[model samples]
Target: MMKLFHSPTSPYVRKVMACVLLRGLQGKVELVPTSPMQNPGDLQAANPLGKIPCLVTEDGTAIYDSPVICEYLDGLGNAAPLFPAPGPARIASLTLQALADGIADAAVARQQGRAQQEEAGPTPRQAAFQERQLAAIRRGLAALEASPPAALAEIGAVAAACALGYLDLRLPELGWRATHPKLAAWLASVEASPALSRTLPPTA
Candidate 1:
């Protein structure tokens, strides 16, 4: 079985888990609970960049990053392609995925900054860093809401939904849903999918 190194709270990891369920590949992949901070060496061994959502294949070939892992899983089942073949539609979906991933990355950075501020002293220029990240997230959300995708099965829609869900999970105070009702509704629709519903993050 393929082994997936992941943290429960990671949106990227959640994406892979959702894809696995959607593609009916659950029986073939093993989930290994791993954290970057708690199991740095293991994560680094699997991925030199020490990222979560690394997939170690049966042959011990490790794949890092959520997109690659997702595509690999999609290939395993010949399920509906999360990513379409090369074309304008494919580019749009891939671009949306990239934007959503960027949003998730920004949100994670902001959360880390806040955590560091509360733990020890604040990191240098933490407020500025956070403001920039928040701005980027907001802009991305606005763009997505303005142009909602036609369907949710594609990689872009999955990424956008996961990004929004992560924001709700991590930074509720931001009140993103208030300003972006369309995006919020889109998220609600996507969340209805059993694959995504099964992987909802637990509330702390």
Candidate 2:
């Protein structure tokens, strides 16, 4: 069986877990809970970047970052590919994934900044940086609303769902749903997937 370094609240890990479910390979992959903030030695060795969602193959080969791991899993079975094959569809899906991932990154930055601010009130410059992150997230949400993915079964849709999920978990004050009704509706539909529901981040 393959081993997956995971975090209960990491949207990236949730993305990979969704792929595992989509491919119907849940039994083949073992989820080992982990955290990058704690800097676990094993996770660091498996992925030099010390990131969660790293997959260690049965033969001890380690694969990293959610996108790479998802593609690797896609090759393991005959299930429909979440990532489209080389062409325009592939380009569009990958681009959507990148944009969604960027949104998640911005959310993370803002949350971390907020935490720092709580610990030691942020300087004006730091507060401005955090606001910038929030602005980027809003812009990304608008772009997604303008051109939502056609299918929830694709990588692009999966990524967009994960990004919105992260925002809901960490930045509910953003009130994204009120501004991007299309994107919110799209996400509500995507959440109907068993893969997504089963991997939702733990509230605690």
Candidate 3:
């Protein structure tokens, strides 16, 4: 069996799990509850960065981060490739994935900045850091609204949905739906899909 360093709150972990579910390999992967902040020995052994969503194959080969893990899973089953073949289409999809992941990155950055702000009592540096992340997130969301992914079929679409879901989980105060209606509508239209519905964060 394969082992996955797992955390329900992690968007990165959710991406891998979404891929696993989409590929119908749920039973093959064993979920190991892990907290990267705690720097667990077993997780570190598999992923030096101690990141959740690290996959240790049955043969002890470890694959890391969300994008790489998603790509790896794309190679597993014949349920149609989430990743496209080499060409302009693949490049476009990867670019969208990068943008979506950047949105997720900004959300995580704001969380870290919030923690630091809470600890240090709201310094100028903390405020600036959070503001930058928020700006980036807004820009990315705006870009998506201008042209959303077709559906939750490809890796880019999956990643975009995951990133949006993560933002909803961590930053409900954003209330992005009112502003970015198209992206919100797009998400609502496919949020019930098997891959997304199954891998949604534990939030209700």
Best by lDDT: 3
**On a 0 to 1 TM-score scale, where does candidate 3 land against the true structure?**
0.97
Which lDDT tens digits does candidate 2 get at residues 30-102? 8898968999999999999998889999999999989999999989887899988899999999999999999
lDDT, model 1: 0.86
lDDT of 3 by residue, 1-204 (tens): 999999988888888888898888988999999989998999999888877789999999999988999999999977889899999989989999999999999999899889888888998878988999999999999999999998777899888988999999999999999999999899999999898898888885
- Residue pairs clashing in model 2 are none
Indicate the worst ten consecutive residues by lDDT in candidate 3. Answer: 195-204
Number of clashing residue pairs in every model? 0, 0, 0
lDDT of 3 at 177: 97
What are the runs in model 3 whose C-alpha is more than 4 Å off? none
Q: What is each predicted model's overall lDDT from 0 to 1? A: 0.86, 0.90, 0.90
Residue pairs in clash, model 3: none
Worst 10 residues of 1 by lDDT: 34-43
